[model samples]
Target: MERQRFDSHQEHPPAWISGYHLVYIQEGEGIMRVDGDPLLLKSGKVVLLKPDCCIEMEVRSGKPLFLYDFSFTYTMISDKPRQAEKVALSTGHHMLSAKAAVQLSLLLEQLEQRQGIEEPLAQWKQSILFQECMHLVLSDPVSSEETGGTREAIEKVLLYLQEHYRGDISLKEVAHMHGISASNFSGVFKKHVGLNPLDYVTQLRIAQAQRKLKASQPIELVAREVGFKDPLYFSRIFKRTVGVTPSIYRKHRHTDKIITLLPHLNDYLLALEVKPFATLPYGGNDHINGYLPYLARELQETKLTGSWNKPDMDELVEAQPGLILGSNWFPINLETVKKIAPTIPIILRDDWQSLLLDFARFFGKGDEWKLWMRRYEQKVMQAKSLLSLSHSSRESVMILTVTCSEYRVYGGRRQLGKVLYEDLQLTPPAGITTKAHYVCVNLEQIQAMNPDHIFLTTNNSNPSKEQIKNLKETKAWSSLRAVQKNQVYEVESWLNGHAPIKHSLSIDVAIDHLAANRQKPWEAIGM
Candidate 1:
């Protein structure tokens, strides 16, 4: 598949194009008259045109509009006409879903990076990625009847169930949530999802229980935490799902303990390298964004250092840092590092949960990891307990930041985004997709949303004092309540000052700063 963006106001080819053309609107607004049928285009929306379709587009935006266009071809071969029919039915060609858009963007980025590379290795990697894209296009269910309104409903229910798996939810409650009779809901859900409601609930509970167990929790407590009322029944379900008793599963899960020396630490014996493990935030430059603080706390609780990036290699050679955790993207020269600290170990952490597991094993704190995880579960419960609390009469306020020139507005899903929604309970405006870890929104769109507070992420290196003063003086910015009231604030980049672990502290400070200006100062607001 080939992906590119077009922004020509002049007319181009009038001839029909072969293969599928999927276009996502990135900015501005326009209309494409396809075969004399007008199709409106707006930001965040995607349109898919089939092969050999006549097309003419007219854009009306003041500035150039951006569209992400993907083109691909597929061959259909079959035993008979029926085979061709089957191939046509099975081939994936549909409008890009919001989730698919995020994935495609990631793939396109990788492909762009290798566009000029000449190595055979680069060619092989590109070929593999192209094949994967083809597979994704052909396997997506959007073109099938299986993915209809009922399927969408099932997806929503599944999401809700997954998010609230720890809570006491029943089939009747789920049915009522969707405003359907229990029997009808159960039949339709089964037909579309291939699992009965009760069975689905049981599977979700069991999966969560397994995660808890793997973290080294006691089986009985894990069972109750997952909503299993009876320990014996939970054991039966666990054995049926995993082919082993809970206790046996836990005992055998730790069978592997292969510790390899980091490319930088080959000189020391494995036994001599036994020291506390520490992890830095995945991205070295923190800027107080994402789940770094939570991950850091987990690391510290497990007796690991929260400051992995600032490790003193010379001191570590003597003190022995059993393992230093980093991400796969770090730019360290591992060979040189190993020569310097041969006695220390190194581990890479890709996600929050995996980091927890690595800490558990390295510190011999497997059991403690389980206990802390349980406490996390309890904290979640306490947060949900406020569902019945009276809603506040105060107006809601949101903090938005614009760092890069793209004028992107951060959304939930990025560390800062997720904290804003899940932790601080702020609601983002509609028509925004969770594609960009920090969303890129145009200035006009930001004004349209009209958030109460606009907290800009500024580096001293950028937006020099003069630029900052000019921006504050702009007519458009001056109209904003935040700008008018001087609510704008600057946060340092992680390495420069705002390290990942310090983000929570920064957020707390920002909240207090905002609260001090609010009319209702008594409202609770803290990280």
Candidate 2:
């Protein structure tokens, strides 16, 4: 072992070396790129580099990097390799605790002291010290279930797999992408993810295939779309993983007593005209937006399910929904939920129209979705006509929601934002879908925007009288044209949305508040 310092790139090291090298940092910082993935390097961090792995570092300019480095090669029992073999092994990097840092210092000191040993007996003693030091240097379990290692990283990887399973993804590519060894990544991935990495990928493809199959996509097209080059092979894996051929799963998918967890799923189900058996518990939370009042009333006779992201195993089994419409937040392992019912994990994206169609396919409700769409279009025309007469000239509209002690301004693409800006032919004074879908701003900032009109939604079941009285008294609130003209008013609660029906209803509500003020926050619920 040796301590060294490098001030610049003048001394260019090879991209990678022959075997594993354990480098323990003492000072300075740099950015290390492994197979093009950048990882931050800092004091007390130890990086274990594997054989043939591409690595490059960008050191902090004018700062020297000080560290101890050692390298070793491993061989299986009863055999000695003449050249390094491409075998799967574990490698990791970590920040050391003070106790571990001290031990590493001592190990390095012992190795430095024994560098000149020549006697056979002395050599044996030196070998023992080397092994002990190596153990201390490489003892961390980067991806081990026994160590209860970081689970968040693995979950991120799982979500990536869910989103991109149709692409040509390999275990080695993912392991390297995350800066870990293939073997270790495989072990922990299976342990926490409940399937072998490749198996998980395969199941994801099969699930997508099932969706396409239900939609009546050709078998060959489904195979190609899901990354399989051969239709027969895809069918084989499909049957093996799902216990049914793609044809069978398509012919019949679990479709009754539906439950949706995320707003997108809930909205899509509502759009299909088949009320879900249950939905996420939102009525009591500080999220009095959207059509939850309607959902709450619907769920009175129906069951009220917990959030899909949080798995309450007993509660889920008891609810016994025949089909569960889940989002990415759903549990990775649905073994228990599967025992009670089929759980289809739907990855929610920003496009809601496509989302509604996908839900229709899953539940065999394409006809119903068509009927709803036809009616929704008719309703849209009626709304447009009503607005054109009562509210002409593309009036500037803003949607500001009150929650807790803060306020959130919705972007043009948000549920009700779409209704006002798209269907009802209004203008968003605050740019269309410009900010994050939801942007938090204070009262002064709202005054700066000074929208001509504001459709406020509060998380409170109804805006409190005291709060209302106090807000109006503020000079910032009184100066806006919306407040002066008494045009700032609460529309319907819009918490449960992201589907066609919700947007359709919100379109009506937006028109009512804008053109007629029938359900005005001050009068409808006495806000």
All models: lDDT? 0.50, 0.65
Q: Write the per-residue lDDT of candidate 2 for residues 295-339, one digit (tens) a residue.
A: 554445555555525555677777766676666754546555667
lDDT of 1 by residue, 70-95 (tens): 67655577666545432332321234
The per-prediction CA RMSD against the true structure, in angstroms, equals 26.2, 24.2
Q: For this target, which candidate reaches the highest TM-score against the unseen true structure?
A: 2
Best by lDDT: 2
In model 1, which regions exceed 4 Å deviation?
A: 1-321, 339-354, 366-399, 402-406, 434-436, 459-469, 484-527
Error of 1 at 146 (Å): 34
How does each model score on TM-score? 0.35, 0.48
